[model samples]
Target: MSQAPDPTIHTLSEFLLHAGTNFQFFDLGRGVHPLDTQLFLDLENGLRPCPRPRQQHAWFAIVFWSEGQKPNHYIWFVKFPIDERGLLVAAARNHFLQIIVDALGQSLGEEKHDTLPDNPYSFVPTQSQMALFSAVTKSCLSLPFNDGVKEVEHYVNAPAISDWRKLSVQSIADFAQTLRDETTCHTVAQNMALYHEDFTRILLESAEAVSLPTAFKQHCAQYCADTFSSSPALALAALRALSSEQADTISQTLLNTLLDSKHADIHVLSVIAGRHYGQLSGHRLIQFFERAAALDEDESMEGKLFAGFFSDLVQLPCLRAEVLGVLRSTERSEVLARAFGHLFSQTQKK
Candidate 1:
């Protein structure tokens, strides 16, 4: 009998295209189809051949077979840029998402299931994703998100994860320093909140990343340690991931870090803190809560959010307070409506 084909393979840029591009396999080798071969070939050739098409941007990614127990596995998606104009391409904007969705889909095609897996790929170990995304994201031009650009955005700004490993300590430091700049600060903050992988160690390892201002570094350390602490072990991992010296300071923030916690009681404390700090950093705290709520992805998540926010928000004297009152009740309107009801009531009182 013929032996099965080698299951282990490295699907980097060139090889990924070779294996999955415009093609798919069934049951390890029973069937095949060329879905978009011509398009890929034409695009590849147009971008490469001739005197150079002067493409606006570039991207990269690393795909590998994840081996583990259970029905689920991971497909690591790393994106980065190659040139100065990497940021200018519209495709570079949402490139990470599109690339990840398409790449992972194509990469895992018919391997485990003929249909798409319910939770195909999520931004879990988000550092690898963020590092690559940040690298490409850093260079993307200042432009609004457009539908036309969505398709190519992810693939347009990818980098080999190895490239992130190659980045210099000083470069990482410089990025931390850029955290001072409003632009970079905004970018880093968003990434921290959005794509955090729960493992801050990789981001923190480079002592270079610590070059950020005291406050920025503190923010990042606490944010990472708190946000990724999904389980007891992961929470321990998150705590350990903080800079050794900085861990103590982060512990203090742990009191206020409930904004992102999954636990209900801690969330109540965050609500209290957010009510007081909400107008200033309160919004950020709320953003964290809302993100957690959305990510919780079910009534369970919302139940916790409602209980926490409902209980604590009322103790405060703001518009949020009234909204909580409505949620506490069975009012069948949107939260925004309740928020406005509070606003309108206050207006009439004035």
Candidate 2:
């Protein structure tokens, strides 16, 4: 939206209509509550394709979007407007931003100010709507949020953005070391964490497959694993940076730690990965499951990798009927259900 001279009258109506839902002339002022999580989940989780509506209106929603930025679960403040083609336009439908802008009377473009501007929205944010927007802006500035923002930013315009492919293990090792550096700005740490998924992708898909130093691999994997052990919330970041864009050695290293081995936290990290990353890379991890299924039988204390992530992934037919038989023969329904919920929540997206 262009900068309007009148800024005091922030229209929540505009924000609602653009936030995703099927409605006609819906009033944001009526029959709704801000941060209606129950309403939010009802609209979001059961979504099929947007049925190109003649008209669309709903409140500024915090959607758990499964599209764009792979494995990224987004709380989109989207505007779901039907184009002439009967398509629900994404970018065109955002409503809350205008409200925020109008409410604050701030300019929509680049700021002349050097420091972060105090966000002007509501007196008290209803939920994560403001925080999500704040993160969107700060994604550029480098800030840490939850790891669910996992994605590979293949920026078309900025090709020169640090090509993780060209880096040696030494360079990545250097970057990881810098995560603890006192002088490294918060902006720098933010950028480093953001590149987690991109780096993982580089490791997975690289043609040349950068060769990493053993020392670097051990250092990164250990720190990330330690962090994962300490905080499952940080696992996505740790996995992304540790496995991404580095050598196969690095990817294998982390996978070995998480999948091949078993700790409660390691299992939790694996479950989260299968939740999000499974959306993109489930095919790759299937074999890891097969190996675990065979090895983890009897749930032995001596040695057994948990197949929670794997069992769910291989539920689809094709590779092995015997595998299905083997999967069913086991009676670990609770563990299996937990895995299913995690995997289902992530992949049940579609």
Candidate 3:
């Protein structure tokens, strides 16, 4: 006689596979983008660390659906803590899995559950984040674009007659995902500067989710260069639009120029640290904190701003070592050293 199959789900991916559902994973930590299935599996199995962690946690969203006479789709926005090495804590994962098993039980994929049960691991994304996630997931699944896509297309094609204010965040997000197409990218690049600053800002913000084509990246770099002196705000907005992973030489030079200038305010430094962090290393990384320290002296924040920003950056696995190196470096400026000392004192007090 054969023994019964062992009823065990070792991982979330295993659980989903066992339930006979189609699914996809999106990393919500750094920026909204598709997470590779294999990479996620490796993370779950302790094979590797999470590549993009935010606030010391690996935040991600899982979209899954069952196929049958009546199909049901569900999304789970969850976060799990990561240790110093950026590895996900297995205890949290096991706890969440236990919660799912208790709530859904044997009917995991068979029943249509309109709402997810209460759990500590779950979270609700912001409206803009939700909109972008929806647009991205739909595009990834090859589903039809929402109504907002048409409006965005028409406006980009003819900006003068269109009302930028009428365009919704959802529409901009949908259009951002379409930048992968050559024609769409060219049209947007040609007309990007013509749109109102507000419209351009939203478009660029949404564009952060997708890897921009060469034309779009060049246009954004040019926009930053042209407006940096005349309209710093617009230049900042354009900078926010750039993707850290796709920063070409021109973009890197532009960022270096911005940091080298006395006008690199706290906001500029913050944007660089937040969005274009991958570019921060070696001389560039040192220059970033130097700028931050200078701003602290001028702003009269008592080094709080610098300390807070440093604290946040040090939590990131990629930047932690570099940030510490900066602190230990004898080459750092006197102001930076003072700032580091103050940061140390603050930490000791706490």
By TM-score, the best candidate is 3
| lDDT-superior candidate, 1 or 2 | 2
lDDT of each: 0.34, 0.36, 0.80
State the lDDT at 160 in candidate 3: 91
**Selected candidate, larger TM-score, 1 vs 3:** 3
lDDT per residue (tens digit) for residues 59-172 in model 2: 343423222334233233333443332233444333434444444344322132112233321123233224323333233224354332221222211224745455443223
Q: Candidate 1 residues 212-302, lDDT tens each? A: 4455545555554564535443333233223321224443465345444554344333423332232213333344335434434444443
Q: Which parts of model 1 have CA positions greater than 4 angstroms off?
A: 1-170, 180-182, 193-200, 207-222, 231-251, 255-350
TM agreement with the true structure for every prediction? 0.21, 0.30, 0.88
Better of 1 and 3 by lDDT: 3
Give the alpha carbon lDDT tens digit for every residue of 67-105 in model 3.
776556688999999888889989999878777767676
Q: Which stretches of candidate 2 lie over 4 Å from their true place?
A: 1-93, 106-214, 222-247, 264-267, 270-284, 287-350
- How many pairs collide in each candidate, listed in order? 17, 13, 0
Q: Considering lDDT, where higher is better, how would the candidates rank from best to worst?
A: 3, 2, 1
